[model samples]
Target: MRLLRVELSRFFSRRAVAMLLLAAALLTALVAGTTIWGTRPVDAAEQARAEARVQAITSSPEYKRDLANCQESPEDLFGPGADAADCRRLLAPSTADVVGRVPLALADEVDDSGIAVIVIVTVLMIVAGTTFAGADWASGSMSNQMLFEPRRQRVWWAKAGAALVGTGVAAAVLIAAFWVALYLVADARGIGTGAAVQTDIRWMVARGVSLAALAGFGGYALTMLLRHTVGTLAVLFVYAAGGEALISLLPVERSGQYSPAENVFAWIRDGGRVFDSSIDCPVSSAGCDQTFQLTLLHGGAYLAVLVLLVTVVSAVLFQRRDIP
Candidate 1:
């Protein structure tokens, strides 16, 4: 109990945590306000204007020419002509097709911009968790802690548990606040209580929480193994940024499933494409050809195994290593 309190105090005492929490709150507010309050509700006037614009563009000679070129291209159909046809076919779909495919209500409810803020917050929280355990050892605080509690393993476990719990609480509070704020804004905007909004918000929040928890546990494990803040942070940044980008660019499709970050993203997307505007598979593609498919259960299992392995390793190290 004493160890848990001490760990919590140390975590909250850091200025970085406070600043991160504040920034997350502010960004959440901005996203909710802009998405729910700023945009006008879609009505007959808007629909008519959109229809008229679509008609005007599709009726244009350029659009007709491109469509004809695509139809005539052998690339889309057969040989050398197929290449030219394929190029022409890359043009945007007809406005009518786009409209037919779009879910205007879902589009209105979704704040795609919120995704950036959520990712940033998750990364920051992971950093905080990674440093929480290893920083004590690096700074010689572990010596004092061990002196007070002779069971080094216990002390390490307590610290890990405390960091996990603290981070989880902070994440939950921020998300809950954001949810309420968004709901209020949505109500004010007269968006109406619809199944789509309800479903999307529920899924987003649930997945966001799971992602944060996974990040927290993973960060803790990495820091425990590395034991140096700079090294751990560097590795985390590489994995979070460069590693994922490289994985995405790989020519081989199956290679992606093995990449940790890609799996995490797949988990977040819940088997769907990450963005509505982007198609996971190209036009005429039969199905999603992801290198890896991650279910929530799979992600949970991976995280659990990682957390258990790191905790065991760290405990052993704590028992065997000399206090600095």
Candidate 2:
């Protein structure tokens, strides 16, 4: 318990961690402010110009080419090998009318903008966790800490507990603040804050916190295993940013589920009526019209396995290798 407390104190003592927390809070507040500000009505002329731009894009030569290709390869283009209604919506002539909106509803605002908070929180937690653990190694302070308490595994557990507690507290607070701000904005914008909307907000907050904690755990485990904070960060950024191309290289159909990036979204969207179709044809050339095919339990299990494997490896390394 003393070691854990010391670890937590060391974590909070870092200026970078404080800055990261500050940055996360400021950015979340900015998101809320922008979301509220976004509700302000646009001028008629501006709305007209936006509608015209959509009309132009829908009718553009490039869009026509894609539509022609989609018609030729509808299944390959979207999913189920053909008849992707959602995909077809994009190519349809009525898309311009579909794109134009006079008033954004409260539900729509939450659905559209709440995703940003999830993304920001998850990524922030991952980076913070990595640096939180990796900083000790980066500073060559792990050896000195171990001189005080030589049990590497104990140190590891302490660091993880500290990381998780930090992530959980931050996630809960930010998610609450974000939704509360959104709710107030929705009410002010003349949108009804109905029971259904509130229910959705509650669910979103729960998922956001879960994802953030998962990211933090994974980040800490990976950094501890490698003992190379910069390398861990680089790999994460690449996976988060360029994982799609790598996912494409996989020959398996519905291979998107194999990617952590996609599964994170799947975990967030699990059991929601967000996807138009749930059927996935991974064995067939027809695409999975489904949103992410993995269930929340499966995604959580997969992520847990990943973090567990890395943590086990990290523990072994910490025990066998000298801290440099």
Candidate-wise lDDT, in order: 0.65, 0.76
Ten consecutive residues with minimal summed lDDT in candidate 2? Answer: 271-280
How do the residues 183-270 of candidate 2 rate in per-residue lDDT, one tens digit apiece? 7766776777789777877887898897888788788888998887788999888876788677766765566666676567666765
Give the clashing pairs for model 2. 75-81, 75-82, 81-286
Candidate 1 Cα lDDT to native: 0.65
| Candidate 2: Cα lDDT at 165 | 78
Candidate 1 lDDT over residue span 1-324, tens digit each? 887888788877767666766776677667666655444455676677767777787789998887777776546544553565465545545544534433224334445644554566577678778767667757877788777899876777677777677677777777666666666655776556677767876787677776775677667767776778778889877866887677667776454554566556555555533322122577777765543445666655655676677777867876787877
- Say which candidate scores most in TM-score: 2
TM-score for candidate 2, please give it: 0.74
> Each model's number of backbone clashes?
5, 3
TM-scores, all models, native as reference? 0.69, 0.74
